[model samples]
Target chain A: MSAIAAGVTGNNPALNIGIFAVFVAITLVVVFRASRNTKTAADYYAAGRAFTGPQNGIAISGDYLSAASFLGIAGAIALNGYDGFLYSIGFLVAWLVALLLVAELLRNTGKYTMGDVLAFRMRQRPVRAAAATSTLVVSFFYLLAQMAGAGGLVALLLGITNKTGQAVVIAAVGLIMIVYVLVGGMKGTTWVQIIKAALLITGALAMTIWVLAKFGFNLSSLLGGAVDAGGKTGEALLSPGKQYGATGTSKLDFLSLGLALVLGTAGLPHILMRFYTVPTAKEARRSVVWAIWLIGIFYLFTLVLGYGAGAIVGPEAIRAAPGKANSAAPLLAQALGGPVLLGLIAAVAFATILAVVAGLTITASASFAHDIYANIIKKDKLADKNAEVRVARITAVVIGIVAIVGGIVANGQNVAFLVALAFAVAASANLPTILYSLFWKRFNTSGALWSTYGGLVASIVLIVFSPAVSGKPATASTPSMIQGVDFHWFPLENPGIVSIPLAFFLGWLGTVLSKERRADKYAEMEVRALTGAGAEKATPH
Target chain B: MSTSHDPGTRPDPDEPDWAEVHGSAEFVELRRRLRRFVFPMTAVFLVWYLVYVLLADYAHGFMATKLVGDINVGLVLGLLQFVSTFVITSLYVRYADRKLDPLATSIRERVEGGAAK
Candidate 1:
């Protein structure tokens, strides 16, 4: 195992860095070109709503499929087999909630941010403030996870094992991401995502076909190979209970994770913001359909890639590697097509991180500039029309710096929970308020505030007290993030099951307790959301 | 067609009467049509997903039962989720095209046309 680990780490770092540098150079040129059209607040924030459905769909997939989906899920399945595929199912299924409940409606009602829709029928300042707060919190947590993952990935792929070296890599990634957002804004960022998505899907498809060919294009043979390579625990790989089925509490935890993954996508600030990049509600719907196909197809590839890694790379060697489960796909690439293939895949992984972080940074900065600064602070009375875009650029730089610092601090910790926390927060904090504001005529400012703040607070509190934070005894293979601490009181790892219902209840309670009802506002919002009447039109450049 | 359209009776010259539109039979029917499809469909998919999760949790033996060579109940069920998602997406798109878009377009045209007048 040690020898195999050493062999995997002996990958050509120079080749990997060379590939990554070329990708960065190309994307920067694209960003510079895309920035030419970004003039207004609309252009900076939403690419002037010029993207066709298919183009936006590919970009959405790029934004949606983070390093976690590509590397994390593939690694997970490679290690855990059937249990790992569960994450893919949860992720793919979550898009349906986005498509059915939110996509077209949000595209019609919102201008730049989720705050736009929430404040449409409510008191603008307070509601916009609440929406911005949640959006920032969600985006920050997600950014931290991606940034931290970047550090670990470079260590594994480029063999940059030194702490300062990994930190430098993380900072460089952050700097590049900042450049992407500051220059291209939404238009540039969307192009980056589109390029990344195309590369990621194509690369994964190539590897998937390669893996299938190894076993005569038979899935059963692939599964059998995985089972065979798994040794003593071989048969367990083909079934559930390997990862989440240890005890009753673990089983319940799986359910909580399921709830979060399925309900969370619709509320994700970054994902929700992507809808504004398209021309119309119909285009938004079309983009979602495209995202579903792209994302769904990518996940199917992960299923094969995971089992293939298990079969070819073997679990023992994968476990011994630096990133453990996260090392699966890269190691599989090495085994199948040697260092060049590994380098290309590593570049794709880097592109995944850069694209996703750019998306989050833009969403967070847009929320702050559009919601907090323009609406809350300046009272939507900016002296200059371009001030919002200027503020957004500055906010992007600040967010990039914060993410860099946070990533360095969280570099070696168990950061998986952070991404899950983001999902939980979105589902609990944002989703309920969005549903109520869009559908319930009686939903008032009080309900939106209560649900957004309440859900945000509840999920964070639950996470702080959950076993994921503490109380779980570290195994020989994995260490807890905070060792020597057992302060956890909440039994579950995911806060979605408890927090989601609590948010819905609080939203209803908050509305009933307040006597504020705006029938006319609700009517206007309903008409606009459903029929696209009086919605923001795509500006002709 | 409506008294609100008469300049003498209107309160705001530019803003359409949204409450009136909301109360119109077409808007009500449109909302109903949307709710009728999405609400039940949402319920169905969520229930289907929860059942799959619950089964995976408690019914380990059942899920592990081999359906074919190296293929088990769990893998098939998981793949079915992908299938179900694709099916639901296609069905919703078709339904929206057939029942929702035409109605929404007419409502939008009438409201915007009224506002212009």
Candidate 2:
């Protein structure tokens, strides 16, 4: 390992550079080809609903395994041990909700965007506007996380120091996603998702196998060695150990993270959109079952990678790295496997960033184009198919540019923190509206609008006030009120628990207060939506 | 292109509507039972998840207080979160199969059934 590092670290930056260029070129070719077939609005937004169950299932997993899973979980496992594994476990379990309640039903009802499901029974313009707003916010925050990770990966791989390099990668990715969606539409996006998913899973599995073999196939001893090597802090390198800070912080951190992953997975817009790719509701349900198996297999491998890093690189080395303790996966790939393997892994990591960011950009565009523009702005009265497709393509480009700028500004923050904030917003804004609209017959349009806005505002406000966002030190020496609000009152780093229920409450309250007769409206829409035969009514209200 | 169908073949009623009505009292009772089951089951699972999270956060003394081989109470509680998720999901599936599915089938029958006349 040392010999390979000595040989490659300073002398072969050119090799890594050449390999990275090839990856970008390949991605460019795929996106270009995909755009050729993107001729109509249906092709651009829904891929004409042509995906098979297994193909869409693989795509769903690709969408879920962002930089957060490939990089974040591996790093967490390296630093925090069992807690890291817990994150993957919680993530997989959330699929049960998706499988049983959401995936099939969503495919059966909506043409595009989550808001369509919520707005099917309500006034068109207000519902579309609310849904579009939620989509943009959720996608923007998620995009920021991926772009930040892209910047980090580029800097680490190319040996560049100036932070402007990070912004460059973000812009390049934003451009790729924009062009892909504009030209190739859903077909191109699905193929990219499939390829990227394969690359990520293969890279993770290969690293896990190599790391395990390094310990002579002895699992128990490897864990023991890691714990001992973690030093006299007596922190169990295999266990979660004492709460991270202030004696009780670890427990709160663990619970909040657990809640976010389990509930938040069902709420993600891009993940939800994958369900719309299938031909039927039953196919959508079948696709989710396949996703469960694929995710389960990948997460089991993450555990090995974490343990391997802990055993091989040691916890002290992980802590010493610049930026984060969670970057152990990439560093370990470099340490155990030579630069060739590391290059391969880095390429996979880059592909992951591209695939996930592209999915988010597309979903946001669909929300804006299909739901807000065609439905709300035009009142579902678009006369020309060609014009509608053109509008969607334009929206895709605009969303991509907005995300790139956000990513550049959020350069120095933790990617995981941004991702958690996105989850909080999703659970607050999207999940409540979706769950209520599907199950509750009493839920009115006023209720959906108020709750969505209420949840979106509340989660954002709470997150901005939390200590995680406070840019100041926890100690008194660096304390000052930014604006007039004190940060101490908002203790939890994530606000999902507080914000999600609040959205539900607002929805219920709004419905009760308005007393609008929406049951008949929804009943008709629901029947048609479930049956898929009625020509869509000219946008409701 | 043939551009036509048999003139004597009348349109099947189910072709337009997609389902048949089954409005027997037995079916209505079954629908009510399914809703009753799903509501309570969802309520129980949600409560269980909340209690698990709250106990982990607020009741630290118990978690920090160790058990065997430095395997503290907190680790056990945390792992239980995974267990609870699977348990809830399995219960949901079972409820759907036994109750929700049949009720939904009945509702579809009512909507599609010619007997609605």
DockQ, per-model, please?
A: 0.48, 0.14
Q: Backbone collision count in every prediction?
A: 0, 10
Candidate 2: docking tier: incorrect
In model 2, the runs with Cα more than 4 Å from the true position are A1-11, A20-36, A216-218, A241-254, A474-488, A525-541, B1-117
Candidate 1 chain A minimal-lDDT segment of 10 residues: A472-481
For candidate 1, write residues A211-246 as lDDT tens digits.
999999999999999999999998999999999999
What is candidate 1's CA lDDT for residue A445? Answer: 91
TM-score of 2: 0.84
Writing each residue's lDDT as its tens digit, candidate 2 over B55-93 gives 554664665555655455655665565566556555655
For all candidates in order, state the fraction of native interface contacts they contain.
0.77, 0.08
Pick the DockQ winner: 1
